[model samples]
Target chain A: MDPDRQSELNALRPDLLRFARLQLRDAGAAEDAVQETLLAALTGSHRFESRSSYKTWLISILRNKIVDTIRSQSRELSASSLADDDAGDDLLDDALFDRRGHWQASARPGRWGDPEASFEQQQFWNVFEACLDRLPAKTARVFMMREFLGLETEEICKETGISSSNCWVVLHRARLGLRTCLETNWFAGAGT
Target chain B: MLSCQRATELMSQEQDRPLSLAERFGLRLHVLICAGCNNYRRQMAVLRAACRRFGSLGGQ
Candidate 1:
């Protein structure tokens, strides 16, 4: 590969890996997917059409690779599932709401104070991602699949082997957790 | 009438699937009366929109 091309590809690795890890939640698998994507891009460089930016092209390849990883994991017999099978539903219920079915004072979503403004600043995503990392692995994965991958709820339920209601519960918990996390770590901390 | 918690749950669930008539009514009523639920609904919108923008950003 040409020096400039190689350097550009190297620079894209971290973003690709973060995307893959968010989906796969396995560092080794994420690394393998990124490596494969880079190799594919290198060989397929001649196919570039310039219709989109080079970074966009690279991310398309990485997205497919991540999907393939998810597919393979679903097929494997006992592929060491990382999500705890016994993650009781009541855990979030008790933590987030009271018996009267209201948000516990500590867990309620606060007014984020100019959240749209935060979207303009690059620093907000770093804080957003840090908050994302704080969620339970499976919850974060489900949320990203819906919000990031644009997958249908049925697709996520099928891929993750969970019921539709269960998927909704996970997504609900994820939103609540992310809202609180961003409030505490980003918006509130920023005095917003 | 839906409680704040129930209203919020329906709001989140609405993103994933269609709500039944009862749920739709309950959410509308609760949101109309409760500023907090209304704000929560808007925040969910902001979150989803941000997620979409981040997906396009590729650097997310």
Candidate 2:
């Protein structure tokens, strides 16, 4: 690889690692996935079409590593998740809603005012990433599987060893958590 | 009428599966009355769209 290409690859490590860490939820495994992805990219550097292949190409490679690790980790994954959440995803949800099942006085959702405009803003993406990171590990994993990887709900159920309803609950909590997080950290107070 | 909590759940689940007639009815009724749940529902949709965009954001 040219020195410029080598430097470029090095720059992508953090983004790739962040993605792996969230998907695998095990720091060591996440590290290994990123390492493998880098190695693959380095060896297959010739395959890249040049100019545009940077993180997009690396992400595709990383996705494979992430899915592979998830498959192998399936047997052990069940230990962390349950048919109903005991993983504290609901702990926050419980507090956000009153006993009457209404939004609390302080927790109501606020208008985001055309969120698409913020997509071009780096600060918005930063807040989005922070919100994703705030989710419980299990909740984040399930959310990514469905929303990021586009995995079917049944596929996620099989992988996580949880029931369909449980899977829905996890994803629900993730959406709620992320929505509230984005609101508090970005939309509601960002003066959007 | 569905509670805000239950309405939110239905909205979330609708992404994964089609809501039954009763669920649709309850959510439609609840959302028509409650501004908070309506906002929550819209935010969840925005959240989903943002996630799709965010997934690719790492690529750059």
Candidate 3:
């Protein structure tokens, strides 16, 4: 391998790891995906056409690896029999929203100051990945399957064995949780 | 009347599936009147953009 290319590949590992972990929701599987992606990228380095930035190209490769993982997991086993576990959201919703289904005063979304600025900061991504890591595993997977992988709601519901309503509910929780997490970790002290 | 909770579910569903006319009306009406739900809707938009940023080196 060319030395410069090798070092560049090494530098991309953490970003790739974060992406894989969010997509796979399992550290071991994430590591495998990143490793495989790196290997494939190196082997196919000559094929690079400079059409996209290096990171984007690498992510495209990582995305395929992730899809393969999702496919294998689906074929090998049943959809998460963890549907019963989905009920835990009742506790979360009860505490955060009022009887009338309004935000508890304390739980309303505050202004997120300068989210565009945060997108430029590498540290913001670290916080983003950490918050994503904090979500309940299944919720994170379903959320990524929908948002990151761009899967349809019906496809996510079919894959997760949850009803369309349940799948929507899970996605709702994920968005709320991620927003809260970002607020606490990045936006709160930064300002409105 | 759409509660914040119901409006949010519709907001979420709107992302994946097309909302029925009634559902869109309820969500729009509630969000227009409710600041918190309005903020919640914006927050989800930011979150979606952030996720896309993570996937692409595409500058925002």
Candidate 4:
């Protein structure tokens, strides 16, 4: 590889690893994804298009690889059963609030106080990660890309090949799911 | 008047930006009549604030 291209790959390696870890949810799979991405980049140098930034182009490639991996694994492990269990759990928890279907009120201003308080609480992150892990694959991916990685909606739409409405829907569902999970599991005893 | 589900949906969007004129009007009318929706709005505001603060910590 040329020196410039080699340096570029090095610069992107950490981000690529981080992206892969979130997408795959396994350190081993992340390592493999990074290796595959770098190998592809090195061999496909001639095909590099100048229309987009190198980082974006490489990320586009990595996203495809991640999706391909997910799809293949999904075929091997029936997602329907997993989805059914998750849906059932959500439904059961929904029943716990009240007959009127109201749960703890939505988050309000001056209630939770400083946002950093939640961030500084390590327990919150643990619960947050657990809640994230429970999301369905596509929803989790969209949520992580948008929320955790701080990717723009447009970039998420492009990377996922989803329409704007679909992206919003996915994010909506993910947020609702996480909110319900946190309330039920983490804040159950806290005064509402 | 917006139903609770409709209000909830609108509230979700409001987390990202100020409600649209229609949404604002609907939300206002709903909250005026429905204490539940008012609480829902407050809940969403708190959630957004918490998320903005806590989300970065996990990313790091």
Candidate 5:
């Protein structure tokens, strides 16, 4: 590789690893995926399209590789005698917070009284992360892309290869799942 | 007319910002009649306040 290309790849490595870790949810797998992605980018240097950012292109490759890895593992598991149990019903139950149209109104600013009181309540990010991990892969991916990465809805849809409705559905389900998880585990004691 | 589920979905969306005319009407009408939805809306508001309060903790 050229000196400039080598330097660029080095610069992008940390971000690649971060994105990979988010997708794969394992440090070792993320590192391996990043290594493979960099190697592939180096070999396919001739096909480098200048239309999009190099980071985007590289991340796309990493995402595809991760998906392939997931699918292969799933196939192997399915091929085994073990029947894949259904987790969908549980998720649906969580997401379906209210059958009736009724929902609690948004809390007023002073309702919580002291802001510091709420902050000191607990580390919410841990709860949030746990809830996120329980989401279906595609639902989690869409949620992360939109909420965490701040990607546009259209961009997320394109990246995930889903329709607009599907994107909305995934986001809706993800939000409901997170909300239910928080309400049950985090806020259960508060009586909110 | 929107179903209860659809109204609830729209209500959640409205929490993020000012609702459009249609959404406002839909949400207001639904909340007026649906006690469960009204409670849900209240809970969302509580959650949002909690989130905002927690959001500022980084500087403290």
Candidate 6:
């Protein structure tokens, strides 16, 4: 990489680190993924001028590294976390719904006009980031594998070592959690 | 008839795969009649849209 390009990549490290840390939730693992991503960017022959495209490109690479880092955790560690993931779900049911399977009165989804428009407002992303932070780490990982990386169910199952049904459950739970959080903090505001 | 809970599960599952005939019919029937579930479906769509944009934009 040229000196100018190198500096540009350097400037993006903070954003990249923050993104990785949010997704991975383990400081050491996040650092490793970020480091490997930067190294890959440095060694690759791809040339770039636009910072936007380069950051996009770097994030794509970082996404893969994050998956790999999570996938590569020691067997015992992965098993323990997987158990944690399973145990977390039972706690969500009563809080979200009643015996009749209806949403609790206060927990129903709220009206949010034009969600896409929030993308144009920079502050919306901060609220979004906060909402994401409120999720359990493993649930967020499953959600990230499916949504952020755009992986299919089968691929996510393979990467996360979860069954298809379990994957669906985690995603459903994550959506409910994130949806409620965003509504409370951003969307349901008097004038968002 | 699917409950609001069940309908929302199918809605989320729709993100990954085509719902089964029974699931599709049931969820649609429930969502049409239930305002809470309809809102949930739309919110799920919004989350999907937001995540896609978020993944690309978070690098900045």
Tell me, by DockQ, which candidate is best. Answer: 6
Write down the C-alpha DockQ for each prediction. Answer: 0.61, 0.65, 0.61, 0.21, 0.16, 0.71
Candidate 6: residue A139 Cα off by (Å): 1.3
> Sort by TM-score, best first: what order?
6, 3, 2, 1, 4, 5
RMSD of each: 3.2, 2.7, 2.8, 7.4, 9.1, 2.4
Docking class of 5: incorrect
Which pairs clash in model 3? none
- lDDT tens readout by residue for model 6, B17-40: 898898888888998888888988
Ranking by lDDT: 6, 2, 3, 1, 4, 5
The regions of model 2 sitting more than 4 angstroms off are A2-4, A45-50, A83-91, B58-60
lDDT of each: 0.77, 0.80, 0.78, 0.62, 0.57, 0.81
- lDDT (10s digit) by residue, model 2, range A1-192: 778778887777787777777677789999999999989988883665665666677777787788788888775557345433455656776778989888898998777899878777878887888788888777788899898777899998887787888788788888888888888899988537
Worst lDDT run of 10 residues, candidate 5 chain B, spans: B51-60
The residue pairs in collision within model 1 are: none
Complex DockQ, candidate 6: 0.71
For residues B1-60, write the lDDT of model 3, one tens digit per residue.
988888888887788789999999888999899988888888888999998877774432
**DockQ score of candidate 2?**
0.65
**Regions more than 4 Å wrong, model 1:** A1-4, A45-52, A75-96, A105-108, B58-60
- Per model, the share of native interface contacts recovered reads 0.55, 0.71, 0.66, 0.05, 0.11, 0.75
Write candidate 6's Cα lDDT for A17-109 as tens digits.
Answer: 888888888888889999999999999988667777888899999999987886787323343576676665666677778999998998877
How do the candidates rank by DockQ, highest first?
A: 6, 2, 1, 3, 4, 5
State the lDDT of candidate 5 residue by residue for A108-154, as single tens digits. 11122333444454455456446667876656665665654445666
Give me the runs in candidate 5 sitting further than 4 Å from their true place: A1-24, A29-116, A190-192, B1-3, B12-20, B32-60
Evaluated at residue A162, the lDDT of candidate 2 is 77
Highest TM-score against the true fold, candidate? 6
Runs in model 4 lying further than 4 Å from the true structure: A1-20, A32-116, A190-192, B16-19, B32-35, B45-55, B58-60
Predicted structure 3, TM vs. truth: 0.86
Score chain A of each prediction against the true chain A by TM-score and list the results. 0.80, 0.83, 0.81, 0.54, 0.50, 0.85
